[model samples]
Target: MNLLFLGDVVGRAGRDAVLAHLPELRRRLATDFVVVNGENAAGGFGITEKIARDFFDAGVDCITTGNHVWDQKELVGAIDRETRILRPLNFPEGTPGRGAAVFQAPRGRRVLVANVMGRLFMDPLDDPFAAVGHVLRQVRLGAGAGAGNGVDAVIVDVHAEATSEKMAMGHFCDGRASLVVGTHSHVPTADLQILPGGTAYQSDAGMCGDYDSVIGMKKEVSIARFVRKLPTERMTPAENEATVCGVFVRTDDRTGLGVRAEPVRIGGRLAPHLPEA
Candidate 1:
């Protein structure tokens, strides 16, 4: 299955960009499944129900969250009702939404989607390594231990603050998961490769927000906050230009191995790298 995974959607700018460009992208890429990080979809904080639904309507198969998952109180209840949205598996038990889910993609194939957050430089949470291991075992067992059992692929979203942590996680899940991509650090990393064990890996998928400013934040506001160290008001989305940044991976159905992985950057100031026809 061909899968597209978008990075953090910062605010209005990011959402607008995705809505405007994703349709064409999906068609051109022939993506069978799409996952977008919506943690900051609502004004660079947390995703709201409306925003999450908008992403769903715009061709995203599942929505993933990171440290900002609960910034908006309404999401706690809204997400529980929807299995398409996923929070980190390592979140303390009793957290409102689910950490993972299995959804049928195109061709009636099952794809297991799991989200886990790295603990290093992040909020205190359960061990991601353990959480992910448990989920992988369940999928493997359910698939009849390599029978493939109508299970086409497994995707892992490692939302992390550090590149080292993300890379480590990718290596840890190399052969067990089909694709292990990272998010949360708005800046995209240069590396995008299929590991020796066949899992696709990217240190960071970048942000699906305004590219003209600093990490999707208004330039002046962020500058002021950091330079002065004063409690300045939060930054808002830029109204004009925006971009969508992410990683796209194609995995084999029978073997659940990644065939191709590439970084995608669109609109705003970034140069276009359209998918090959």
Candidate 2:
């Protein structure tokens, strides 16, 4: 159980480079649990509760979102009391927050993230593989009777915009998830694998901000709305120095899956990965 998913943090140079390198990346990847993707973290779109309490005081235990998760508008009523802020589990059923939960890490285990949101070219909610197979049939991962009382890990972000629906929701949560990353296309995709039904896929874990613009916005106003097709302003972000993309697994405490999976660029313009802990 080592998990760490990041991707999608756009504004303010991707939230000051993930609050300045996520506490040395959770002490050089010995991380016990940490999910990010604050739906473009405030200026590129949504997410705001004082920036989700400054990403939970920079330790980030959970916070996922997609479809701009309500572009800030008071987080649609403060995300129904912020249960660690998650949105897009096929919204529409009183959609406010929650797309999935189950936190508690550091030894007592039990992870279960799950944010989900991929309806082809976007915004067609529901049926994100039947809402992630009804929460993977109420969690079950590995520990005893078919992984005992379940949940020891099981990330599953998938906030896609079609990379074939984020590699078909990472082979449909293969092996019942342990990673299955991907976020609203900010670029970073080199296919960090582990699949073969043991989860830990990648498809895209890109955008933490400033990839020299145009995915993190601000490339000459996204190139004049694609060479003057119309609307020219309104696309901020990309305030320079930012390059925090993510994904990093390491599960299997008792069959919880993902034995290991890397890809986690750091600092500015890409070209740096941190795995071996």
Candidate 3:
């Protein structure tokens, strides 16, 4: 099955880019499932119910979030009701909304989607590795515990700031997951490769927002803070055209392992990478 994982969506531009192209992109790539990180989708801080609905309407299978998942106060209640949306699993216990779930693919396939946040340089929540390992144990590839015949694939989105932590998670889930990719840094890394264990791994998947600014924020304000060594005006997302960026991976049906994976960037300032028709 072909699965697409999109990085953080910054603002209106990011949402527009996905709505305009994701449907067609899914068709061209023959994607069976798609996961989009939407923590920053609402004005660069937290996702709202309306925005989450927009993504679901746009063919996104599930939405994952990180540290900013609670930026929108109203989202707390909405996320609880929406099974398609997810917050970081390592968030404190009793947190609203789920961090992992098993979803159905169009082709009668069961797919597991899990999201976790890293601690190094991030909020110290539950141990990500432990949380993820626990989830991994709840189900296994080709052998679902009464959920179905078996899980056809697993997608793990590691929202993290440090590359080392992200890489560690990838190695930790090497043979157990179909794809392990990182988000939160908003810069796409070029080290897309199928690991020796058959899992697709990428350090960072980049953002689905304007790349012309400082990681999708207004450049001038971001630069001022760095130069002045003090807080400036509140950061807002860049409004220019956004480039939807992420990774595309195809996994084997029998082994539930990744066979091909690569970075995907379209529109805006960056050079594009799309599957050939």
Candidate 4:
């Protein structure tokens, strides 16, 4: 099975890029399941139900979020019903929405998707390592006690701020999960590799917005906010010259081992990896 994981979608440009390219990319890659990080999809804040629906309509199977998952107040209720949208698993217990779920791919394959938030350089949360264990157990067991879902593979999106912490998780979940991809940094790392244990790992999958801007934010506004150290208005997304960044991983259907991992950057200022067919 092939899983295509996209990083944070910034704003209009990010949305348009996905709408314009995802279908073709999926076709070329023969993706079975696609997950996109949408924490910043709506104006670089929490995702709204409408935006989430847009992403779903655009062929995204599941949407994962990070610290900004609650940016949109409306999602408080929408998340309760939207099983496809997942917040960080490490959030305190009783949080709205789910942290993990088993979803069926087009081939009738049961695939597990879990999201967790790291603690280093991020808002303090429950231990992600422990939370991952809890979610994994649930995925292995299914809904009822030991009833079992026979899930063919598991994918984890570790939304984190620190590279060291993210790399640690990749090793920690090496054998148990098919893919342990990182997010929240918004910059794609160059260390894409299949771990010794068969798990695919990447420190950061990068953002699906303007690469010329500061982490998808308006360049001048972000620079002023940083250098001036004042309450400058948040930078908005640039409308022109968009790019989409992510990682494409193929895994063994039965054993859930990663067979290949590759970084993808298309359009905008980033170098293109996709070639003419």
- lDDT, model 4: 0.86
Q: Each candidate's root-mean-square deviation in Å?
A: 2.0, 15.8, 1.4, 2.7
lDDT of each: 0.86, 0.86, 0.92, 0.86
Expressed as tens digits, the lDDT of each residue in 1-277 for candidate 2 is 7888888998999999999999999998889888998987889998889988988998999999899888779888988888988897888887667899887787677888888888887777778888888898987887533345578788888888888887888898899888888888889888889889898898889989989988998899879888888987688897999999898889878888998898888989889888888
lDDT of 1 by residue, 1-277 (tens): 7889999998988999999999988999998889999999998899998898888898999999989999998988888898899999999889888998888777667788899998888888999999998888776622422355436788899999888989999999898888898998888888999999899999888888888788888888889988999998867866567778988888776677788888888998787666573
**Model 1 ranges with Cα > 4 A deviation:** 141-150
How do the predictions measure up, each by TM-score?
Answer: 0.95, 0.35, 0.97, 0.94
Candidate 3 structure quality by residue, lDDT tens digits, 21-48: 8999899999999999999999999999
Candidate 4 has its poorest 10 consecutive residues by lDDT at: 140-149
Best TM-score among the predictions, by candidate number: 3
Candidates 3 and 4 compared: the better one by TM-score is: 3
**Clash-forming residue pairs, model 2:** 142-147, 143-147, 144-148
After superposition of all CA atoms, the RMSD between model 1 and the true structure is 2.0
When summed lDDT is taken over every stretch of 10 residues in candidate 2, the lowest stretch is 142-151
Cα lDDT of candidate 3 equals 0.92
Model 2 / residue 236 / CA error / Å = 16
How close to the true structure is residue 164 of candidate 4, measured as C-alpha lDDT?
96
